[model samples]
Target: MLEEDLLYVLALQRVKGIGDINAKKLISHCGSAKNVLKEKRQTLEKINGIGAFTIKHLFDSNNLIEAEKELEYIQKNNITTFYFEAENYPEKLKHCIDAPILIFKEGNFDLSNRPIISIVGTRKITSYGRYFCEKLISDIKQYNPIIVSGFAYGVDICAHKAALKNKLTTIGVLAHGFEEMYPKSHKKYVSEINKNGGFFTDFWHNDSLIRENFLKRNRIVAGISEATIIIESAEKGGSLVTADIANSYSRDVFAVPGRSSDNLSKGCNDLIKRNKAAILTSANDLIEMLNWDIETKKEHIIQKQLFVELDETEQLVYDFLVDEGKELLDIISLNCELPIYKTTTILFNLEMKGVVKPLPGKLFEAI
Candidate 1:
């Protein structure tokens, strides 16, 4: 059975033309939806934005009956609903400027316990971008952070897949609702994520997958995560919106630098140039920037174990690349203070050992 308070709130959410801010105002003035429903038109008219037309629509018996039917539909589907006051609601999201008063959940997972990092980017990512995403996510999974994404293609899917491989939890925040998953191809993978963690949405089951819903969903993604990472995004991609929202919320934003000529890299480069995002070359950079203690302790133990194995030049190169991703020749000459020819030899050796890759244009990137 749906709780009476939740039922009333859900009904309020279903009211046409009523948005979060207005709903909040109504609730604050009337004390609750039940009370709001009993108030006459004159009382409601005094509130800004609630004119006679809105009051009439809000109070119509037909609308109330339809809302009750919608509540029944939600119950029939067994979807769990949460209000902002619920203890299970995400605390981070509660502080968002336009936090949802109610959220509908369809899976079994504890959202509050996991540290979330939202990974977003272009739907058309390059092979290099894919590799960067996979390796970084694989490295960070040891800490068991919950990965959050929009379940779109490219870096979002890559991050979720990597998280699954590492046996970590992942959640996809959909723009629509539980009635159907968008871009249907993601259904299979989304099922896997739900089995591991869960899927989240704020819209009702019948809500259509509209464009504005996605922009709104981005806020939830940003709010839920401790930080946001842009793997690869074009100059005008949704990932930029997520990054902007994350920054607005005072969360760390990280961007992987891509080739300047690549169109997809423009957004990332722009972010770096504007000093809006930190340049992330590796998982350790994120760990350090976020002041993550788990990986730091683990690195200390691993360093002690490898103290004697690396030669002076190899050690210098490795140290430089350990917490940051660098171009092959860049680090060798920059850190070891060696010539390009000598650096190339060391990079070749490192590549042979599965530690680095030759990126486009003589640039070597560490794995």
Candidate 2:
């Protein structure tokens, strides 16, 4: 993305009353953020869902001023900005209608071929939750999945530490900006996380850490990945909300089953009983449901069948694997510009056709 275009996007983000859905609608109709901002009020009003009130705020001079300052901070600090329409933007997140038009990134971990899973739960985790969360990430270490969490106390921190201990990449999704770290004590771990993985936030620099932001942040936690795992929660908590968001996105949701009487277990158990989430007793359940683990072969290459008829989407994914030489399921979806679930189905069909095969860690290679 060009610097000028990004500036306009940042400015558009600052426009009060215009949320992501409307921002996207405006951008889609106008061509670019710059065009959206420059469009006449009458023209913008004619666009669907963009009401007169939103257009009233579109010409606010302070929006650009703040955007320029934020852009300067971004440039000086090496912060990465992800535009929703960019090829480099997260593929799964792109499918979410409410996903931020611009998100700030501060990390160095690669997402290639790695299944991103968000683990969220209560801040006051019990011994059982801690034990299960740590062990779960450790058990999946060999698969080299990217663990995502809210970076809070209890279950969130436990997930991050477990990922670090296993030498696996972990991402801390923040509810605030990089300028201020919440739960100040966790600041010590920031350097290490940045070195290994990194943090993601849609909030601008100097944004306040308020209560409502966490709910908004939960959507990112749920939207950015292929699935969400809730270790523990009270009957009603933010983690459950994340699970709901994940479900709304048609992403897999897993909850650790526990005794009904336990407070922390109630959320997970409720989710399971309500059929909102799968009962995740072990890592194997997740592995099987996601088709993330298949038999490991001695070699990566296989004899791919020739002259097999394939649809346009199947051919797209198959050609990508043949050309890319064994890519992850999510990576294939990203580069092929297909939804993750659709990519999974296409890969399954390709496997059935004897032209592709699944390997451990959700990898696929041309037969």
Candidate 3:
């Protein structure tokens, strides 16, 4: 976006009652934010859904003044802004109706052509949650996904750290702005995170941290990725909200199942029971659901004879492939009575053993 255009967009963002959807509508109607701001109230109100209340403050001069100050801050700090229509904006997030029109980014990582997933859960994470979160990232690290999460305590930090441990890029979606870091304790991870991935926020630099900011932040966490995973949540928590937001965007959502008696597992259980989220047990579940296994085929170079031993699970999949000749991933999973993710994992193992190979369109055959 041009600096002059960004100034108008930032001013429009500061306008009361003008949200992303309306901002977009106004922009579409008038060709640009600058045009919208300069248009007469009667001209703006002629458009559908543009009520008197919406454009009442649209022409406020303070909006321009404040935007100029923000522009100065952005220029001095070298902050990057993603206009919704720009090519640099996240592709998946752009499809979302309520996506922010302008999001301030402070990261060096790219969001293109890679599988991205958001991992969110309770701040009060348990030992099981921590273990599953860490192991999940480790197992899926081969796919080189960009992990997305809030930079909070427990599951959020755990996901980021696990991604770091696996040498994967991990992005933190901040609830506040770059002016200050929340929780203060997490300040230590900022430098390392930026080196590995970075941070994104729609909030201005001067925005203050508050409780509601978390709920607002959840939308980005959900929208920016191909899938959202709730490692663990109580019967109620912000992670559940993220799941809802992901579902609303028609994005895949997965929740790790926990023991029924566990408190942190309640929200995930509810999500599964309500059919709002798929039951997630391993990295394979996520991998298959998101079709991330397809990347392996592109990078495939190893071709081995059937000299490697097959474990029980791998043998089951291999045998099925042998009998079926060629089968879709879903068919293999159904016939083997394995979850799709588990089936994908088995197929990957079998491919490594050189007795199976993935065909086009997610088909697999015995080699």
Candidate 4:
């Protein structure tokens, strides 16, 4: 966004009682942030859900003055701001209704067309959780996915470190603004994180670091990715909140299962029991569930042959798969008028001959 426009956006963010959803609503109605500030209270109140109280502070001149100060800090620091509607904003996050209207980014990472996943869990990570978290990233390293986390203790930092060790970009979403770093010990890791991926936040330079800020920051960690993985969590924690937000966004939520007696595993187990999250056993489970394996295959070229050997049922299934390009296992079986077991047997044979490959979510395609 331009400097003049950013000034208005920052002002809108500073307006008391006005938040991302309302700011977006006002912006949509007025055409721009500048117009929203200039619009009359009576006119704004005419819009549905725009109560008198919402616009009570709409005409505050101090908003613009404060915004100007923030803008100056932004310009001097070279911080990149992402307008909610801008092309450069994270695509998945854009679809979220409650997503931040503006996000300050501080990284050189390429987010375009990359599969992003959020890894979160309890701050008191155990050896079991650490092993699982690291292994998960390592297994998926071939896909070169971008790993996202809160950059706090436990699973968050573990996931980031695993991503860096694997030479993959990892983003650390902060609960506070750029001016303050929570858990001061993490200051040393910021340099490496920026070099690998970087930090993101909606908080301003002078925003305070508090308990509620962490809860609010969970949304970004949840909404910015295709999936959110909870490696380990106690019965109640912030990671569970992030997982809930991810589910609310209609994104995939995966929880690593643990023994019923394990304290840290209770939250993940409960999530699975309540059907809020799918069971995540390994990287393959996630790879298949999100169709990452299919995406990886699409990046490669595969040659086709007209004279590949196939028996009667195999030919029928092969022809159906070839015509459809890709299909779910059940869909393929139903369409081919074959029993699921028989279809599975044929698909296995085809896979052995490099004719078809199985994907996560029980999807398959002719190669």
Candidate 5:
């Protein structure tokens, strides 16, 4: 059964024109939406923001009909509605100043347990950006963190795809409502996520995807995540908004350093330079910083044991990649305890077998 508090909060949120401040005031004075709805005009007018204008609208028969329609729509959609006091409500978000009184969600994953990390960046991500995103996400999945991102193009899609590929639970916080998934092209992926993970939003199903909604959505992403990582971002990208929010919440922010000449990298570099975020060059850097309790140290031992199965030259090359995140074929050969020709050939065989990935300029990273 839907709890009384949740039903009241949902009813309040679904009201046609009631906003956050007004909702809070009404709830504070009347004790609950159920009680507020029964209050007379004089009682409501005594509240701070519930003036005569608000009172007229509050008791308008049409507004009551609209609220009923909204509740019906929510029920039809099979969406789980949460109030701030609900057991399922996100604890972190409950503490925010402008926390939504109700959130609508559609999914099965538990949002409260998994450590969340928001991956955000420019929508105009380059080939390098995509590659970094895929590799970084793949490495981080070993720790089993929940990946969070807006379901936008470029880095956002890349992050979701990588998380799905790695079989990790991911949450796509939407700026709009479930009535329509924005960016129609992402419908298929969004459906898949609903089945396997979930989507989050503060607005009811019929709410419009306005510009201000996205700004509001960013705070949810930052507030939920334990940290935020910017893969690539232009100087004025939305990813920076998330990072700034994360910083405000005292969450760790990490940025991947890109070449200064690259416009996509400018935001990340600026974040690191300004001391807003730590520079992240490898997955291990993030893992170490978070002090994640993933059995990484044990995995290293197991990896060493498996290394005994490799030939002498392959072992040498593997060790080199493990020690240094590099792409240069020459560097591997120079550092290996073998000749260049042998080292190069072994690296190719390893790459084919899914043990390592060849980066541009012949650099190889362990898979």
Candidate 6:
């Protein structure tokens, strides 16, 4: 993005009452952030859901000044910004209604990993939760899914370390700005996380840490991934809130079941009981639910002649399977750069031609 465009976006973000949703609305209606700021009050008022209170500070000069300073800070610190309407933004997060209009990512993480899963739970994690978190990541490391979590204590840190150990990318979503690291102690591990994945936050530089900010940041944690997993929680906590947000987004949620007598398990049990989450017993539960299969082959393959006639799209999927050996439907679609529906049709055609066969767990292989 151009410097001027970023400046205006920052200024829009600095507005007191206008949040992501309203900012998006205003920008969509006016064409751009600069246009929104330059548009007259009468015009802005005509836009629905943008009330007097929301736009009262829209024209504040102080917002622009602060934005200018923040823009400088962002440039100096080498922070990468993801705009909502841009292709560079995370694809899964783009579908969320309340996703951040501008996300500041500080790290070398790649966001292309399919089947992103967010693991969240009580800060006071139990031994069981810790064990489950570590083992789950280790088990699914082969699938190469990115693991996401708040960089808080207990389950979050455990998940991150486990992902690191398994050489998998892990993202830490933060409540504060890059200028300040919460829980000061975790600062020691920031370098490793930046190398493996990185931290994501919508908060501006020097934003103070407040209790409410944790809850507000939960939306990003929930909205940025395909599923949210709860390791352990009491009846109430920030992780439960993340689960609720994920549910609201129509994303899958999984809760590791625990003993009824355990205090930390209450929140997860409640979620499962209310049908807010699927009971996650192991990595297989998540793998199967998400249809991410790592099983490479079935009992046997029906050999096909070398000269099977195939069109361009079918050839693409066929070559991908031949090279990959075996892969899930979504993986094939992603690797071949084809849509799932189109890939499914191509796979069906290949199957009819006796060149491909569907295995269990939605996997397919070249025959």
Pairs that collide, model 2:
302-367, 303-367, 304-367
The C-alpha TM-scores of every prediction are 0.76, 0.81, 0.81, 0.82, 0.73, 0.81
Q: Clashing residue pairs in candidate 5, if any?
A: 327-362, 327-363, 327-364, 328-363
- Model 4 residue runs over 4 Å out of place are 295-367
lDDT of 6 by residue, 1-367 (tens): 9999999999998999898889999999999999999999998998999868889989999999999999999999999999999889999889888888999999988786566999999889888788999999999998898999999998989999999999998899999999899889999989999999999999998998899889878999998898899999999899999998987776788998989999999999999888788899999888765657534222222234345788988888887887776677889989888899999999999999977866533668675
Quick one: best TM-score, which candidate? 4
The predicted structure with the larger lDDT, 3 or 4, is 4
Where in model 5 is the C-alpha error above 4 Å?
1-7, 14-18, 40-60, 294-367
Model 3 residue runs over 4 Å out of place are 295-367
lDDT (10s digit) by residue, model 3, range 1-367: 7899999999999998898899999999999999999988998898999889888889889999999999999999999999998999999999999999999988679988888999999999899899999999999988889999999999999999999999999999999989889879999999998999999999999999999999989999999997899999999889999998988776778899988999999999999888788789888777665556655532332232234677888878877865675677888899999999899888887877677766433667775
Give the lDDT of residue 208 in candidate 1. Answer: 84
In model 3, state the lDDT of residue 96. Answer: 92
Residue 173 lDDT in model 3?
Answer: 96
Residue 181 CA displacement from its true place in model 5, Å:
1.6
Model 1 per-residue lDDT tens digits across residues 1-367? 2467666787777777777878888888898887787787799989887777665567656656666766887778877776776687887887776778888777667776667899999999889998998899898886779899988888888888988888888888889978878889888886778788778898877788988998989988888888899999999989999998887776778899988999999999999888778889999888865656655545653654354355677657656665554443655587678887877787777767655555332445444
lDDT of all predictions, in order shown? 0.78, 0.88, 0.88, 0.89, 0.78, 0.87
**Regions more than 4 Å wrong, model 6:** 294-367
Error of 6 at 364 (Å): 22
Q: For candidate 4, write residues 1-367 as lDDT tens digits.
A: 7889999999999999998999999999999999999888889999999889888887889999999999999999989999999999999999999999999999779899899999999999999999999999999999999999999999999999999999999999999899998778888889998998999999998897999999889999999998999999999999999988987877788999999999999999999888778899999888766766765544331344454677899889988986786677889999999999999999999988777876434567777
TM value for model 2: 0.81
